[model samples]
Target: MTRRIRPRPRPKPHPHPLQLYSLRDICTIRILRFASSPELLEQYTNASGGLRTGMLMEHLDSLAGSIAYKYMLGPEVETLGRVQERGFYIVTASVERLDMLAPLYPVRDIRLSGQVICTGKSSMEVAVKMEALNPNRREETLMLGRFSMVCRNASTHKAHPVNLLIINTREEKVLFKMGESARNRRKYAALHSLSRVPPSSTEAAELHSTYLKYGQDDESLALGDRVWMGDTLLEKTMLMFPQERNIHQKVFGVYTYQLGFANSCLFTRSHVSFLSLDGIAFRQPVPIGSILRLRSQIIHTSPPGQLPAAVHVRVQASVVDVQTGQEEPTNDFRFTWTRDDGQTVPRIVVPRTYQEAMLWLEGQRALKMGTQIRGSRLQGRDR
Candidate 1:
């Protein structure tokens, strides 16, 4: 069947824009200083001796906040000001578009740098890069990513205005434009969400084909080289400890992210390298004294023969009510991982229901976009 619901129209841009801060004025850089301290370096290394990308992920959250506070507090400020006195505090709105440019090694120091590339009336976009600082060799960029942050009124809990950024140079203009494009892509994705709009003819036809091949309810379909998506899931249920809470009793986003990452790794069951983060939003955080059930699924995988084949995993963070035993979704995380040995995929994931089909298609879209980004970075080109 054809699509019964079409995408909504794009909103018009504001006529006159106010630009104030130069890209340089809001820039921030952090050095790991691991070269001098072996103990410090070990703290960031995983069991396989590779850098812990998971820890770095949480560090990015802190870095984003630090940059936002730096923008408002000016340079040379070493400590964050009290939120009560500042009248406002920054919170992470969403994490988006993280692509690994190269493998991170623990032998050298790494520099994390980013700046306020774009700003709205109450929102700001922070772009960050992680680079290996080589002493006698060329510096290698390890990662590139973006974070969306917003200032909130401490008392009112409403969106607060931030400093408007000024595009002073051509480079700054390019970054500002990229931020705008990212925002547009987010809107487009939401508009085409399966819940909001009907599937197109192509998607409908594909789902039908799958249904014909493997009947939905039949688990013993004698499937060869293929497995039901639900069978490839890993789940974990745990209580939020006091250390994980941030908002008095509400758990923060960092623990959710870490749990999601670990769940994906377990599902892969191999030495997988982080390819990219499709997206993660902190719409809601699981509260303390609540049971959190994190479900991770291998939604999509590359073809058998593609070198360095990857898998796309989606982790759903949900809170389970104790009394009624009902589940409430808190957040969803999308991640792409490549086999560290660069081996082809072993199996394919098949959706078993209409909802699974929609999630599978969404995973397909995220994988496609992530592949393009990773390709561009590896080829020394910008997308």
Candidate 2:
């Protein structure tokens, strides 16, 4: 009998310069060399209670803005006016947790990296990936989402043709194929409109009343800041409510996400495209009695308009403990404002307009789906 030895395969080289590097490498380079770095945790080091979710969402939005400007736009697109010259852009964003770590540190951090995956006559597809990066934990994949944006000529204000490029990888090719499916493709497009509820709905009307009652003249108004270019203000508050637990008194993910979405909308200027979001993370579980202080800051802005030349503003929120003044950021989100033109604007008289109403409905629907699955599992166990 004869024994044979096989040689190990050589490492393959990336085809392009961009392929050689990755989102992590880009984040590291930006951290070390760029003047604007990811918002440090030091700011919300002591915030607690309801404020934690708000602050985390704000941080996520800021992260999205930084990455979008750095990679997507050119140097010419610097001012608020330039950003507006682009079309109606929305920040379709979400957050996911990686692990259970101490309240003081991030179990995992999120990074938004998007590339032009494909193009059509008037629109383009951007494949965005969120990666988990922690100081002391193993790497993990959080989630993946795709965004479809249409670019137009700034002068004509009409949809223009894009020079669609061919994808280079087999994986990307497959994703593009899945995206091309009429049913799946429609799902992505319809999400924007489907997430909205009618302005006349009972819930929409209730939320409107709630906004007028509580958001109009509270001390929380003092903390408000200009997060956008046009006539818009951003106000935030962090508070707590009681909840039931199953042996372990843990805060619910649905509640946390809903809170994050609500706060993001609180200061958001209605009638604008919510373009892009980034750097969202869920670190520690918000426990009962934990006073969460949501500290939010308005960092950047773009032009405001409805003719595709709409401005986008970026905000970041971090959560901290009010009693001990220790921050345990549980979420980070981003929001954008798009002015309404004849074809794009929302018809509403109050703060809780039709668009806002629809958004709340869609959010509730998503939350219910998660709860239903959990309830089903619980029932199965009991049976």
CA lDDT, candidate 2, residue 5: 81
lDDT score, candidate 2, position 345: 26
When summed lDDT is taken over every stretch of 10 residues in candidate 1, the lowest stretch is 12-21
- TM per model? 0.86, 0.35
lDDT of 1 by residue, 276-379 (tens): 88898676767777898888888877755776677888888889999999998988888888887766776667887778888888887788888787786678
TM-score of 2: 0.35
Error of 1 at 169 (Å): 0.9
Candidate 1 positional error at 271, Å = 1.8
Task: Quote the lDDT for 380 in model 2.
Answer: 44
lDDT of each: 0.78, 0.38
Best by lDDT: 1
Q: What is the C-alpha RMSD of each candidate to the true structure, in Å?
A: 9.3, 20.8
Question: On residues 1-383, what C-alpha lDDT tens digit does candidate 2 reach at each position?
Answer: 69888999998642211212122222211121111333444343322211233344333333443433333343234433343444322232223211111122333354434454444565544444444455576634333344454544454546545443455568667656744652353555346445442334665565556455433555534544212222233435545456532112434323333333443334344433222232233444456565554433222222123333222222334456576776666554433333333233222212234443344444333333333433453454346
The list of candidate 1 runs beyond 4 A from truth reads 1-19, 205-224, 245-269, 287-290, 321-326, 380-383
